[model samples]
Target: MKEKVVAINRVAKVVKGGRRFSFSAIVVVGDGNGTVGYGLGKANEVTDAIAKGIDDAKKNLVKVPLYKHTVPHVMEGKYSGGFVLVQPAAAGTGVIAGGAMRAVFESAGIKDVLAKSKGSSNPHNVVKATFDALLKMRDPMQIAQQRGITLSQVFNG
Candidate 1:
């Protein structure tokens, strides 16, 4: 799996003599297919924190349905103060996104998509919101089933 570090933060705690410092990392992992996951880890060192994040990400892997190397439909998601709108794009459109939202799409193996991240730009919140949108996507087959129609009928109608 490929892993990308979305954010690394240094946290300090006040102590009697001095301050205790630690690191926190947010990571995204993917197999370059349709499986992706995100993780957060904390440790005394950046490397350790990243390692933990990768392991955690593996534990949370999820499969996304891809249609022609793009999202099946428009999607919107929100988490805390972050909101994201995701839409499918043509094959050559490429990934039109930025910052943490870009990382999430790349990790999810989506090659063509149009995304806009609104509200808070916080990487943590953006990542979660992106996942929320991705997880909410449904395949055409599922939609057809839900509508109690044959797959061909869905397309014909």
Candidate 2:
């Protein structure tokens, strides 16, 4: 598994010594095999922030069901003021996403997906919304089981 830093922000706090500066980072981690996660970390240094972010991401890992390099159906997720729409794409269409969403798709090993972020452009909110959508995904077999029906029955009926 590997981790990627999606964004880094510098924050400052007013103190007796004028200001104290810190770093905040957004990180995505994955095995490129249907598992992915994201995290936010704050620290006094860049390296520390990134390391913390990766560690946090590992703790929040999520499994994404892949269907021929794409999702099985279209879905939407929302967090705060951020909204994300995700849809399956044909082979060779490639991943159509931007910023945090792109990092998420790549980390999840999604080769063909169409995604758009709406409303808020904040990286934190966007990442959260993307994860929300991925977590909402349901596998066909799981759905069939929940319905007490066979896979073939699901397709035929």
Where is the poorest 10-residue window by lDDT in model 2? 64-73
How well is each residue in 117-138 modelled by candidate 2, as lDDT tens digits? 9999999999999988988998
lDDT of 2: 0.92
Give me the runs in candidate 2 sitting further than 4 Å from their true place: none
Note each model's CA RMSD in angstroms: 1.1, 1.1
> What pairs collide in candidate 1?
none
TM values, all candidates: 0.95, 0.95
Q: Write the per-residue lDDT of candidate 1 for residues 12-57, one digit (tens) a residue.
A: 9999989999999999999878899999999999999999999999
Number of backbone collisions per candidate:
0, 0
